[model samples]
Target: MIVQFKDVKDLTSSPAKSEKIHVYKSGENKGKTRKLNAKPARTGILPVSEKTVWTWVREGKFPKPFKMNGRTVWRLSDVETWIAEQESKATILKEGA
Candidate 1:
């Protein structure tokens, strides 16, 4: 069977449990994978300042951002994964120490 979505809402609304939802910008990359700017990136699940984020990126501790029309953006998934890894590492360290 084939299904057709009439609008963005339709597409965003009922994803399967195993499916991953991707939020994207409205312009050229609309409906594609989402990208977060410095501000949003800093305000994510594990909040951190842009400066710290950049420092971590430079030190190979965080995900790198890609250029989007002269603007730098980090993939939301990548940020989430980084946060998860950090939490996992912290848990391991706490357990060990």
Candidate 2:
């Protein structure tokens, strides 16, 4: 006869954070951590062409997408921040830049 026991600490421990989870956890979500499955972002909510997205990324005007399993993807938070930045920059340019 044999007895097996599981480590009790393992049951109480927090799950390890993935990159997406970490980003959401680091005060990025108004201090709320979102699910890791939260959709990655597209430049336009209306299906933007790849060239536009890549152009901003290349120009350092957009958050660089991450390589995931051979596919490039950007986090929702990053894309949102980039959009806000672009809007602000556009306003500043119109004013004087």
lDDT of each: 0.55, 0.52
Model 2 TM-score? 0.44
Cα lDDT tens digits for candidate 1, 1-97 = 4432121121122312333457776988787884343221112344444456667879998767777676666666666677788889999999999
Question: Model 2: which ten-residue window has the lowest total lDDT?
Answer: 4-13
Best by lDDT: 1
Cα lDDT of model 2 by residue, 1-97, tens digit: 4432222121122324444653344544666654565443323342444565567669986667666676556666555566688789899999994
Over all chains combined, what TM-score does candidate 1 have?
A: 0.52
In terms of TM-score, the best-performing candidate is 1
Model 1 lDDT, residue 29, Cα: 77
The Cα error of candidate 1 at residue 6, in Å, is 26
